[model samples]
Target: MEERARTEEEEMTLEEAFVRLDGMVERLETRGIPLEESFQIYKEGMELLKKCNDKIDTVEKKMLQVNKSGEYSEF
Candidate 1:
């Protein structure tokens, strides 16, 4: 199941994942959601969070590569 989630996440841009995560947050915050459904949303949110972090990491690595001095600098 995680493998499938990762594959799907790979196809999703970070902005899209952020939008999905925001929706999940709104759903979780609303009244009347069942406990089970809330748990599912939480799980999906975590997965999206991980994907966003992975995407950010990839971008940071590329930024570092572009810098010839091999030192981290504020973008």
Candidate 2:
């Protein structure tokens, strides 16, 4: 059988992840929600934080490993 299309949640991109993280921070700062809801928001924020940080770390690591003496390197 053919594979089904994945929804936005399943296909979240790095940009979308950052957007969510920003919104989470805004809500936490606003302090309009109840304590229980804030806790849930905090949990999700942490997960997003990890994901964003992981993505950045991965990119940085890849850049560091790139040989500066390779053909693409300047003289």
Candidate 3:
């Protein structure tokens, strides 16, 4: 199930993931959602968090890959 969701997330941009995650947070905080739906949102939020972290890690790795001249380079 998670693998399937991850596959879907691959098609989403980092910004998209952040937007969706933020919306989910707002919904969870301000609305009275059902227990089951809340759990579903929680699962989706976890996936988004993982996706965002992975994106940040990838960017950090690329940023760290610098040449001796201090310019970015392929790792």
Candidate 4:
């Protein structure tokens, strides 16, 4: 069950994660948000950030592999 949940999160594209993070930031910046809600948003934003970082790391590794092979191919 946990693995499935992780797979679902990983299925979100990096771009989509960025958009969600941006929206979370906007919500966090808005005035009069309840403290509990703000905390929830912060937690979700952190998760999205982790997802973005994971995607970036994967891409970087792929690029490195391609470079090592001295070949250019679509990622």
How well does each candidate superpose onto the true structure, as a TM-score? Answer: 0.74, 0.63, 0.71, 0.74
Best by lDDT: 1
lDDT (10s digit) by residue, model 3, range 1-75: 978867878878888898899999888886668888888899889978888898888877777576889897765
Candidate 3: where is the Cα deviation over 4 Å?
Answer: 1-5, 64-75
* Candidate 2 lDDT over residue span 3-72, tens digit each: 3322443357788888888898899888568899889999878866776787777766666343656534
- In terms of lDDT, the poorest run of 10 residues in model 1 is 64-73
Residue-level lDDT for 22 in candidate 4: 89
How displaced is residue 8 in candidate 2, in Å?
5.8
Rank candidates, TM-score, best first: 1, 4, 3, 2
lDDT of 1 by residue, 4-50 (tens): 87788889988888888899999999999999999999988897898
Global Cα lDDT for candidate 2: 0.70
Cα RMSD of all models vs. native, in order, equals 4.1, 5.9, 3.1, 4.1
Residue 51, model 1: lDDT of: 78
lDDT of 2 at 14: 81
> What would the per-residue lDDT of candidate 4 be over residues 1-75, giving only the tens digit for each residue?
978867867898888788888899999999999999999999978987988898898787677335567877655
Task: Give the candidates in order of lDDT, highest first.
Answer: 1, 4, 3, 2
